[model samples]
Target: MALKITWRNILPGCFKAKSPTSPLEPRNQVSKTNSLQRLSLSDISNNGSFFSASDISNSLIGFGSNLHIFTLKELEMITQNFSSTNYLGEGGFGPVHKGFIDDKIRRGLEAQPVAVKLLDLDGSQGHKEWLAEVIFLGQLRHPHLVKLIGYCCEDEHRLLVYEYMARGNLENQLFRRYSITLPWLTRLKVAIGAAKGLAFLHGEEKPVIYRDFKASNILLDSDYTAKLSDFGLAKDGPEGDDTHVTTRVMGTRGYAAPEYIMTGHLTSKSDVYSFGVVLLELLTGRRTMDKNRPSREQSLVEWGRPLLKDPQKLDRIMDPRLEGQYSMEGARKAAVLAYQCLSHHPKSRPTMSNVVKALEPLLDLNDILAGSFIYMAPTEGKKDNDDVDIIGNEHEETEAEKNEHRNVSEEEEAEKKEHGRHQHRKGYRHKHRMRSFRSRAVYSDTALYRTYRTSFDNPKLQGQDIVN
Candidate 1:
């Protein structure tokens, strides 16, 4: 019988992280290679078998037969029995791990580097999330979507494995301390790729509802190509001509659409709203909600939503790292697209497909405005989601509170700028001397990839040292 997760799977909220109770050591434990070259296809594929849709899909009617299936023991072994050292990151659903299966087995099975996710054994919440991910990734297929190889359901264990992405997540690249500076062109490509993925999910034939679409969930491959991941909060929309899909409210605080938050009515436009916030992050290089910012400015969506409506303010919103390298036309078009996504009314926003069309020509640096075709007229005098106060729950800050918040943010920004300058100098030094550092020592070894530990020493390290 197929396994399923439910509220009963979740442990009490008081559960704590603990060491694994395994007698066997991990397969390997090598240090990481910082600047590795891509593995050849032959290296990636030693065996004839590999993951595909047919492997996991149900055999009848070709509904979901292409999917791959993984045994629980295989996942445990690949992830060193889910060792804490192999952890990649975590989310509302569970922690992610970086691990490898045997090259011969993978090639024979046609699998590539895979990430494993182990669900927490809490209760109803865990079950719902598990079901959500299975229902969506089990069936959805798109170039921009992350591929799920297989899953494990053994006793209390519930895990899912996916193709590994080297560049990490869009959120890390955009907002984290270890994030790299993305060029304007790359940022635009990511946006376009992400939009296309969402369009596929919300396409006419089988409209899948992605309840949580944010920067963090958008993982990047080594080449910096974006792939949408994490579907634990996803939902399939109601069928037919129904305008909206409604359910219990579930989303990140800053990215949730105003209408959805207020009315509990969801639509593909809800994802569009979150995408707008992500675009703002790409353009401004800011977090959607940062405690380090002044209270009034803590919410990036609240601060930048108004500015997005005006094309002239686009320059200020664009990431300064681009150093004015982006074409004005390109920035303007992006601003307009962002404005549409941020539309207060769900009906007023352009469909995800339409958003993809608007971005198609912008991909080329040369022909940004050459393909500018306006499909929808801008709505005038529209009421914004923040304009209405539905709950009437008043949480006011005294003048003292406001002053304290402002002071804290000012100090934080000062530190960030100071750190930025230091990093810039260090990077310059690295680039100049990097030629001499290129050796087999900098490359990935067969045994190294399988045995690397993902642990972070918390006590002596600062926040910036956590990921690297």
Candidate 2:
């Protein structure tokens, strides 16, 4: 007599041997159970043959125990039968729906909302991509990385559940015309948070290279805190002295590193370069690739890199929507840091750790401005002084003093320009004469320290908060 092996005994919670149909059950729920029955080993096996216990154990090991194996019916119920009202947004994988899971569905878990992403059968990516997301996000956890709540792998259906991000993505915030422009401080905070996420991934025992790092993949919270999302395209970094992992070139076009695009070799530096592109977007409020822009300015990196070294030209590239709210010194330093990250050679770029250190100080500049800014009332009939405020070391000046200062500064600037032109003409005949352009090297540690000291050491203003 052939020994019978029940699926209930083998897979326990994963499978039910003889599920009785209930009149109260929804039609879709009944179909889902019927689908599970078809995948049972008894139907596939010849004459109900029993399998060795070791075979069952090996198969179960691949399924992560830490992840909750959500049934298709459960997800459907939570998403209100995938109602149109619950639809969030569509991506390459599929459309995401907002869902709420209570303790009734998942015992011991708190009641909270989640974003369920159902895999599109005819989409560009399939089972392999789904499996990659489950295997990576299920294991990696960080404050700056979006949390993976659970996943469903029933029959032909595949879905992922993640913590709902309140503010959507960086791409929407940065590009949407109706959205309020993110304040300079908010942009810096987002960049630092994102860099920390990438740094975490790179510093892992077995490093992970975030092959896809674009503004769209960076999700923001209510407070404008940024979190990294979408692990489908992530790959393990090269191990043990290996420089890079050779793979098919894949990533958003404008953000892919120059070397990574030229060669299939991928490294952690590829992610660093992509971060720089997004940082540029945050700084300048420009898209990586925009056909609407002038032909020469279509590619942001190519058009912006040269301007980063020149403070006078850098202001021209800044986002006009910012309305001169950002500190000039801080913006110049950030531009220099971005230029370094976009270096032609990967090795020349700083590690994510160093990138974090560089950005931390920039945040203090905003904090100081926020805490120390004062709104002074304008004198009657003094329309010119109506909108003026003392910033940094400058004190309020009388109209006469202001005019005199402006005249002197204008005269000095004209003299310098005339002197520069004369020197250029004199050097026209000298073959080896070189004109020095300011670069990242100009941002010395001493200068940065002095800037930080001046901002942070200022006494807080005693009045109503004015700067918004």
Candidate 3:
């Protein structure tokens, strides 16, 4: 049934955005490195991946992708000829403009706001990147990954359309100057959502490694639900006996895995290391590399990693923007997880699924802690101890919460002894991370190849075909 699409419905309430091409400062467009000195031109552009626009157009039907094929003229009309008022912001990819789509506009595309990304032909990324996004986001769907609605590939022009994320990227939300700081619970929630997205990729049938997992690529919806974006640098993970994918070292400088930068050994663990960096950014409210800070404090991982393990040192590194809002336990656990994920040894990092398990328990901690007065800072003379004077309230934690925390502590201690070398000292497997916010296991670590999936059907559009 085709719903009536009125002009009023086309420009929704949020569509009245004011602009002269720039509203908020655009998110930082970090430079992506080309392959090493030995690689040829084809290798640097990831031509080996066979993701040409024409190639995708011919094979997309077989890939089972149901994405709409939009014409350039259709997009121009929706975006008001790429008007300045409709312009959202720019990134490394290209300038994005706000647009609307409905069944009236394209038959199968739902009536909703969208962001149209016009590929900058002369810019850093090109058709290969565009095709990668169309293929990856085309076939793979998850709650945490952004929805790629459709695309236009016409006469040397390439564009991608995605669901408009209200709050924009995590980089703008977390690091934008003069913006409201992200609360502790909200940060944890975003972390969990982003981690789930990565977990879904790594847990897929042919495991995907999101080559670029940085703050700017994680967008938030109106509800603040984090969704992974930008599949430009994404690649399939190694299979069978293969341990790692050797590819061009292409990723933003600060977020790329050290081992990958050193040897081009791309693995799911590389993404984990990047996640750890973002987690650290969330905890500290700082960029991975901030030259604005003192020379000693510029590199977040360098200055912050040492403080994560020591509960006493944890507060010194926490985001001062939080204003003593996070519980000591919650903060410490997050730091420890960040520490483990930032492990120099790839094998020492926990999987994304495990990262999700660890983050889930933290969701409820802040609410209970704040309301029950369980997370108050120690008063003068009680500086060394964490025992908080209880407030008279029904918000107090039940005995079960205490027992659960105790059990988690015991398990952590046992795992501590299993530490192998310097790298393994911080690493632990999946079992220890999930100790239950609600005391329920929600993920499967044994899912070798995406056995653990929540079904989602991409809407099939029959209106147009790709212009090859």
Would you estimate the TM-scores of all the predictions?
Answer: 0.65, 0.68, 0.67
lDDT tens readout by residue for model 2, 348-386: 999998999999998776422221123333445767444
Give the per-residue Cα lDDT of candidate 2 at 434. Answer: 11
Worst 10 residues of 3 by lDDT: 459-468
Q: How close is candidate 2 to the true structure, as a TM-score?
A: 0.68
Candidate 1 global CA lDDT score? 0.61
Candidate 1: 10-residue stretch with minimal lDDT: 459-468
Candidate 2 lDDT trough over 10 residues, lowest sum: 458-467
Model 2 segments more than 4 A misplaced: 1-65, 366-468
Report the Cα RMSD per candidate.
20.1, 14.2, 17.1
Off by over 4 Å in 3: 1-64, 366-468
| Model 1 stretches with alpha carbons more than 4 Å out | 1-64, 103-108, 123-125, 367-468
Q: Report clash pairs, candidate 3.
A: none
For all candidates in order, the CA lDDT equals 0.61, 0.69, 0.69
